[model samples]
Target: MSDVTPKHAAALVALDWGTTALRAYLLGDDGAVLDSRASPAGIMKLPAGGFDQAFDETCGAWLASHPGLPVIAAGMVGSAQGWVEAPYVETPADASALVKGIVEVTAANGATVHIVPGVLQAGAMPNVMRGEETQIVGALAGDAALEHEPHGALIGLPGTHAKWAFVFEGRIERFYTFMTGETFGALRDHTILGRTMRATAQQDPDAFIRGVDTAKDAGHAGMLATIFSTRTLGLTGQLAPEQQSDYLSGLLIGHELRGLNEVLAREQSNLAGRTLRLIGNEALCERYRVALERFGCDDAKTVADATERGLFRIAAQAGLVRAAVRVN
Candidate 1:
């Protein structure tokens, strides 16, 4: 860590380092982005002793320039196999819990990088998340209503493993994991359902909605039972090859939400009228929005730049950025 910073504007350097990709952010005093960077070098993708190299390559210059400008990293970079394991904070965990669980990795030059810990909901059916904790914090930062939603809000992070976190009073209460995205990928790439499917750049919203409606009406039989209809509809000419992929995607996502609603119903909480915030890619969140509407959920929106905001929020919590004001 050398003192090479030019303007001294950057207050923090944050990294959302996950399984397949890593993104870095330089934040100002107000948690605004001053600069940013990214790479494909995730923890799982790194080679032997490559973490140091990847770290240096991705944000070395920023760190070099800022010297001790607090560096904070979230995601798999803090997992058991990451640079250093940051232990999981249990459910009902808040930003304070994440700060308490922070672990550090020291560079050869004695620079310290703070790694944020993941959250775990311990129970018979245990659920865990790493990088998403930061995203959740970011979502909360973006919306005040979600933090205090009377019945708690559902924050959906849709991807390979979709996460539905139930937030109450600015804390992560409990969550559910839907393997919807990954299942769709497997069925599309390896299963017979993929054989007749054709890839296209154009989207078929009609076909997608149809699949969602079908899932809502006939999904009570369970996922495995209704999932097979994807191929049948195609075989019967109701779904074209080009429409099969999107249809299958809709089916999986629809089923995921259906299950989520059911689980909420069991807990005396319901998703139908709940305030839901989604965090993920634009198109994917839009798709989930449509599916949620189909399930009678009228209030759902996407939170942009959740990861960056969450990283900064956590960094500030850990006294890494935005130094506290002292009373005169």
Candidate 2:
């Protein structure tokens, strides 16, 4: 058993335990992903005392093959409602800070698990994020140029709650969240606006562009009135029912970008010429890029796989992996 363990002992297991899904990666000692698997055992789905069984069921084979497999997890799995409530680390912090805030727990399978803490921005307008922090760490590590920039980099992560962050010197100076996606979801599914909009897998770029343009022209002050235009356009025969959803999507995303512009202005940072690094999946990042370009920020670049790389980087910083081993 000991000899078998040494043959394919994964350096560590990285888990992205989010609100609705759980993804696991078996990484080699050098930070390369050896094998991966996932399950629907997200924290939200677990009943009382179910996390241990769920985890063991998901990765029991790997755990048995490599005794005491060190597991590092990020995302809502560390939230107050997660397996163990990992606390939040304040901003102006870096990857090291994230590693330091890790909370350890013994899983039902007896595997040593470490949960990465979320990041918080305190004061008048308080905001917090859980899993996104690890992705930020990975983004900065992947793009070294952003860390040394004198003015810092503006990173936009689009999702349920899109995050706009200011990173400098390998630390998150401050960040803000916009409920653009969630708002869009609610309006499309629960409000009258959804009734007039058709659901289709293929998005209409033309309609989306029109919405982005309108949003940029209206600015932040016009958001209240701008959203109403979704229904008004359809009523007036200006917008097709099938195009309404993409149009609304553009409008909300535009609002988010415009709001971010305003925040950057207040902070005296220029978004006109600087290249903005957008970290997320290709589809979402493409939408943000389009909106940003329409809003006069043309240098938006999308990066994929930042989350996986981030998990590896954070694990290395915590000295969790000291040597390489084969993984089948």
What would the per-residue lDDT of candidate 1 be over residues 1-328, giving only the tens digit for each residue? 2356443367888899999999998887677688888899988999988888888887888877767777899999888789999999999988999999999998655568999999999999999999898999988985776866777878999999999998887889999889888888988999898889889999999889988887888889988888788889988989999998888888888889888878888878776777889999999999999989998888889999999999989988887775521100
TM-score of each: 0.94, 0.93
lDDT by residue (tens digit), candidate 2, 260-286: 777878867666766778988799899
Off by over 4 Å in 1: 1-8, 323-328
Q: lDDT of all predictions, in order shown?
A: 0.86, 0.84
Model 1, global lDDT: 0.86
What is the lDDT for 277 in model 1?
94
Provide the clash count, candidate 2.
0
> With candidate 2 superimposed using the best TM-score fit, by how many Å does residue 282's alpha carbon deviate from the native?
2.1
Highest-scoring model, TM-score: 1
